[model samples]
Target: MAQVLEFKLPDLGEGLTEAEIVRWLVEVGDVVAVDQPVVEVETAKAMVDIPCPYAGVVTARFGEEGTELPVGAPLLTVAVGAPAAGGPAAGPREGTAGGAAGSAATSGGTTEGSGNVLVGYGTSEAPSRRRRVRPAAPVRPQAAGPAPATAPTGPDRTGARNGNHEGPVPVISPLVRRLAREHGLDLRELHGSGPDGLILRADVEYALRAASVQERAAKAPAVTPAPAPPAHAKAAPEGIRTPLKGIRGAVADKLSRSRREIPDATCWVDADATELMRARAAMNAAGGPKISLLALLARICTAALARFPELNSMVDMEAREIVQLDHVHLGFAAQTERGLVVPVVRDAHARDAESLTAEFARLTEAARAGTLTPAELTGGTFTLNNYGVFGVDGSTPIINHPEAAMLGVGRIIPKPWVHEGELAVRQVVELSLTFDHRVCDGGTAGGFLRYVADCVEQPAVLLRTL
Candidate 1:
């Protein structure tokens, strides 16, 4: 007699009710080992490749590509147990489940439910069954049995289904559930260290760290887990309460916080950037990546910060101290479909023009692709927002959180300016800098702006600054 096993979609991240199945790595009739990648799913944060947790001959693929399957939905099936007699002896082969690996399956097809199991026998725990796609509408409750399993805490718990209680109410600790949910670790796979096989938070954390190491050693890079949306994230029947759970949501929250917390003062100046334009054109002609006016503006900001260290400080609201940094890490406001992401280029004060150009190029590309790491989004000493690309004149940009100052660059246009004592059409750009008054005085801001203006007027001044 053959034993069958099913693989359901495990929670891939926190409270993720559904996930878009991007691609299937395995097909029907393929013999797979435990922990081998089976499918790739695109969540809000990144594309995650899920690993198979069973070793056997694959029999079916329940969820097709592009389908948004809920957690605990059957993803694939396998038949464990003996092979058909007179055909081939199917016994446990080692190196797969720590149980067996055998020759690939010969015949199979993608199906919705169980089908055509054979006579061979292989052994493992019975596969966890899948829940129905949609739960029946809740009737008026007569009586309650027990509380259901809580959602896991991390990004990996994305595909977790709604409440289902069938097993003996497991004694799940709060932190364990939080760790499992946050990291997307499947609680079912973890053997508990607590009494009565109760999994502890430490056990889950250990498993996560160990598995991450193994994954890295196996050449599969661990993806940055997107933070979970709030628990109260729900859609009302009358109006939608979409969770700000992804990159766009994050950007919105950060911008809102900055605007709320920072006491801002805006200062504006206009500068002739004719030489800066010429330098940019020369760089583009010499096989550079066509670094934008934004890059030039960023370089100037770095120089300005060097002259006035107060602008490079952050208002420490919690400690009521002004935290200052010795180095400049200038963050550029990169606009993406997921709203705006500010990816910082560190040590901008130390890098030359070409290096700054390349770093900004790579960072912005990663931002647009939604592949930027959490580290890339943090640790900026100052920020620069370029509205020039959008043909805007100038507007005060709100400073990013904690950071005391932000510089906004406006569009450069050919305008009449005093050049060699003659009013001639020259490239002119507007600059707006908003600083927290608590950290810097007005004189410092004015001097810094003048320094930046001088650098923009003569781009070669940056060569000496570097």
Candidate 2:
């Protein structure tokens, strides 16, 4: 007998609550191996491939690609255990599952799955079978019996105004419960629009809105409703609307929070980068691992941060303290097809030019390929935004939220400038530093920018601290 075991979407760490399905690797009736990536999902942070822990013939798949599923929602079901004679059991072996149950499926050993899964799958229970996608028109939950509903609490649980009989509430997310509790709305009275009887946040909100409408309607006198707009006005020009979700949504949220919370200030300077460019060209010509210009700039940044440590920190507003970190995890902005992602290099203060170049290359490749992990996307103490690649000269970049400062570098172009007192064409670059005003005043910010400008003009200035 083949026992079908269902797998749910695991809790991807870093407080991520949901994921939008991007692609499915396998189909129903296809055999999959244990730990083999089954689906690619786009969370708010990054793109990740979820691997199933059970090895068997895929019996069923849950959602279509691009469907947004909450954590713990059913992903698929796999048939485990032995088949009678020459069924899916005798097919080509994909790979074995963890232990005994896999042994039975392949070698007629024992039953029961190994339950050994990845790190994020910690105690994630198998979700009940509820596969239908919610249609736009509201549908009431169909149950084996009437799905048991919890009665409303507090003083509002009186007779006709209260919820139904008390029992289990089919809600998975704590956030949904919190929203309902705060509004004093009865979850049992509303029809759920989720899989099975699961009460979602949208359902609660809809119920609240409906109640408000009814309350207002009851107090007002009956009147004729307004007519629809004329045909000419209805046929007005329309525009393409994109849903703000996934990485784009995350960027929108972080940037908005940064604007709301951080009291930021920007300062800029133009530097003759003739020396910095020469230093990089000379380093490559000498033939040791080729160093990137970004690496050299990062080296200068670390050196400048050592002199002015206040810039390499985040302010704790609630604690009323400016928390200065001892180590620097430098984040650099990389624009990709997906969106703009800032990949961080850990312990950047400790890396040399050669090491920094290698790490930057690795991260940039990952960013372009959409394979960067959440860990690589976060934990940046200070950001370095080189907007020069776009062929622009200077921009006052918004601070990457929670981080205190971001340094922007503009395109290095040949321009007429005074070098050693005579007019000449020099490689000039603009450097802009944006800092949280709460962390430091104008003097500290100015000194930091000046030090960076000095380093760009004379590369040897960096060597003193290196």
In order, what is each prediction's RMSD in angstroms? 16.0, 9.2
Evaluated at residue 310, the lDDT of candidate 1 is 89
Q: lDDT tens string, model 2, 252-346?
A: 99999999999999999999999999989999999989999999999999999999999988988888999999999999999999899999999
The local lDDT score (0 to 100) that residue 466 gets in candidate 2 is: 76
Q: With candidate 2 superimposed using the best TM-score fit, by how many Å does residue 151's alpha carbon deviate from the native?
A: 18
TM-score of 1: 0.58
lDDT of each: 0.65, 0.75
Model 1, residue 100: displacement in angstroms?
Answer: 17
Least well predicted 10-residue stretch by lDDT in candidate 1: 117-126
Tens-place lDDT per residue, model 1, 293-401, is: 6666777787778778989998777888998899998898888876777888989888766778889889988877766654467788898888888998999887888
In Å, residue 352's CA in model 1 sits off its true spot by: 2.2
